[model samples]
Target: MNLAEEIQKRRTFGIISHPDAGKTTLTEKLLLFGGAIKTAGAVKSNKIDRHATSDFMEIEKQRGISVATSVMGFNYKDVKINLLDTPGHQDFAEDTYRTLTAVDSVVMVIDCVKGVEIQTEKLMEVCRMRNTPVMVFINKLDREGQDPYDLLDEIEEKLNIQVHPMSWPIGMGKSFQGVYSLYEKKLLLFQASKQKLDDTDTISIENVNDPILNDLLGQSSAAKLREDVELVDGVYSDLDLNAYKNGEVAPVFFGSAVNNFGVRELLDCFINIAPPPLDRETELRQINPTENKFSGFVFKIHANMDPKHRNRIAFVRVCAGIFQRGQNYHHVRLDKNFRFSNATAFMAQSKEIIDEAFPGDIVGLYDTGNLKIGDTLSEGEKGMYKGIPSFSPEIFREVINMDAMKTKQLEKGLMQLMDEGVAQLFTYEMGSRKVVGTVGALQFEVIQHRLKHEYNATCRFAPINLYKACWISSENKKKMDEFVDSKYRHIAQDKDGKRVFMAETKAWLQMVQDNFPEINYHFTSEF
Candidate 1:
């Protein structure tokens, strides 16, 4: 296919949700529809003797939680779909945030019982800020949960997004019948199957009051569905593709991901309406997906994907044109041109080398430790892509070496993990004391686990007396030098050798800011 045709036929999106909200299960079901996997892996259960495909890391499998983003690609209904399963735990928000930049749209999973949790709210806020197109999947309907209408209201209020219900559940819990797909005007009766998804009994109803619904489901359940449909229609306007594309509206779907009920409805509607690869903003200009020359950006760098080989893969989202293997492309940050002989596409951790990839696809490039997060590449241009920034860390701890003989390994692992964007590593100028900063305490555990298993390095985290880490710069070179000299104890450099001030307290930071008005302290690395 031509570049335009290829771009039009591709869909790239990220799956996000709160922990235990069935996000991974929903991904497995979607892959099932796409014929990517033979049988769905049990997310939290070991009965199947399998773990979630997205949870490929050993730590993830043991904890039953996703700590890193995993990419999977497949073809369904003649459309190439690139799905990124992101960590739902708040500790990995940095990684998830970067994943959002590579995706054209988002599928937010919410538990029917919990509605919207704290992590879900924060993730939605990020999407709202970027005006990213989103679709909601209300998961786990087989279990007794909140009233569907009440859950929808909670989502609308808490998420701060107007929601249009594309599909509504008939009866939840033990009385659960099925879901009515408003988009296709069909009724899909629910069935409990722990193994895989089978073709459910579907009946197209041009009319909601059709007698077949009553015959299939009891009279009361059928009546409730009709009443709910009428109320939904009266309350919300019809789904507008343009409004959804603009991120002004979200189309919601209800389902039990584990049972594979109502998942097809979500996937079918998604492939039909979800926006394809759109233009990405760069420092120069917006690069359209239809452009003839290849241009893409690296949003994530993962280390030790294969612990034995100690492989690090740079995940690049193809933004424009076609990426041909062995073709030389300009690395904008490094200002060098290089050719990649191995460009692999992902199915969780397993990958196969591909000769070419098109826009809206994520291809992994093998790295020998040079790639960093937010690095941009192009056919020949020198411009960089914008909007990929690291947020200031909320937690800080000093890394204490546990094995003296492995000090070099410890340092190597720390630097490599920092480059993966999981945390920020800083070094004290005088003593060279290494400190790690993260969004949550859990990240320290993930890093520690990776350090031992993958890097063969061991270290313990000791609490450091620091409130925040800020990158400081100033137009006045003399003043900046004097500030660094005055606060020598608090001076440090980040992984990229950028100067940082390790604030002892908020009051102290405020005092310094007031005293040195000319000096600028940026909480995020964007400036």
Candidate 2:
């Protein structure tokens, strides 16, 4: 297909939610509909079934929570869908934040019982910042939960976005029967047989009062469905596409992701109405998706996806034009042109080589060591896009290598992990000792675990007793040098060789700021 046609055929989005909201289950069900997987694997299931496709990391499988974002693409109904499944745990917010920069829209999943949550609110804030359109899925309808009306009120009040219910449930919990479609004006009866999840048995009725509907849902459920449909029609009579595209409103669908109920309808409506890949903002100007020049930016970098190969991959979201295999694109950050022959697309842990990809496509390029997150690659115009913002670490720890003989292994593992943006690495006294900083304490556990399991390097972690980390820089180079040199013991260097200072208390940070009035103390390293 031509570039313009190809771009039009692509729909890219990320799945986000609070932990245990069934976000992963919803993702696998969508993938199953797209023919990406034959059978969906249940998350946190016993050893009998394989783990969820998106939770490819061993740590994630073991913990029953996603820690990193997984990109999976598949073709359905003549449309290419790029699904970015992000970690729901607040501890991994950094990974999810970075993944948000790569997608055109988002699917916000909410557990019916939980309503809006902390992580969900935070994620919605980020989406609003970018004006990214969102679709809401009220999952776990099979289980007893809050009233649908109450959940809608919670979403509207907390998220500050109006909701349009595209599908109204017949009954919730064990009394759950099916859903009445608001858009299609039909009643859908659901009976799940996940062993054959790929094949959906559709029972659509035109009349809600039909005897078949009463027989299927029983008289009480059928009457409740009638009442709900009437209320939905009177209140949410119109779905404003413009409001949706502007992120002012979200179209809501209800379902139980595990049983594969009401999922297909959601997917169909999503691809039909979800906005296409939108233009990206850059320093120079807005880059439209149809532009002929090939340009893209790196959002994420992962290491050791293939355990045996130990290869590093840079995930790039194509912003404009077409990307061809073996073509040279200018690396704006390095100010050099590099050609990569090992460009491929992701399917969870698996990858497939492609000859060309379009604007909305995210292609993985092999990186020996040159690529960094937010690096720009373009064939014609060379300019860097806005970089991903890093969050300040909430906890600090000094990493001690148990095996001094494996110093190289320790350094290698730490460097790779840092490059993945998993955590911030710093050193005090000019690299005499190494410390790691993370947004959550669980990250320290993850780092130590990965080092042991993946690198064959065991290490001990000691608390650094630091409250905050600051990146110190100033226009007055001489004064900055004097300040850092005088406090060399307290000063440190980050992975990029940037000067950092570890503050033991809020007073210490304020004192340093007071001393170096001209010096800028930045909490995060901007991409």
Instruction: Give lDDT for model 2.
Output: 0.88
Candidate 2 lDDT over 58-167, as tens digits, reads: 88888989999999999999999999999999888888998999999999999998889998999999999888999999999998999999999999999999999998
lDDT of 1 by residue, 1-527 (tens): 67888888999999999999999999998998899998988897775469988888888888999999999999999999999999999999999999999999999999998889999999998998789999999998898999988998898899888899999898888888789998899888756875666674777888998888788888888888889999998998889899999998999999899988888899889999999999988988989889889999999999888877878899999999999999999998888888888899999989999999999999999988767899998989877999899999999999999999999999999989999999999999979999999999999999999999988899999999999899999999999989988999999999999999999999999999999898999999989
Off by over 4 Å in 2: 198-201, 207-212
In terms of lDDT, model 1 sits at: 0.91
The collision pairs in model 2 are: none
Q: Which stretches of model 1 miss by more than 4 angstroms?
A: 47-49
Sliding window of 10 residues with minimal summed lDDT for model 1: 193-202
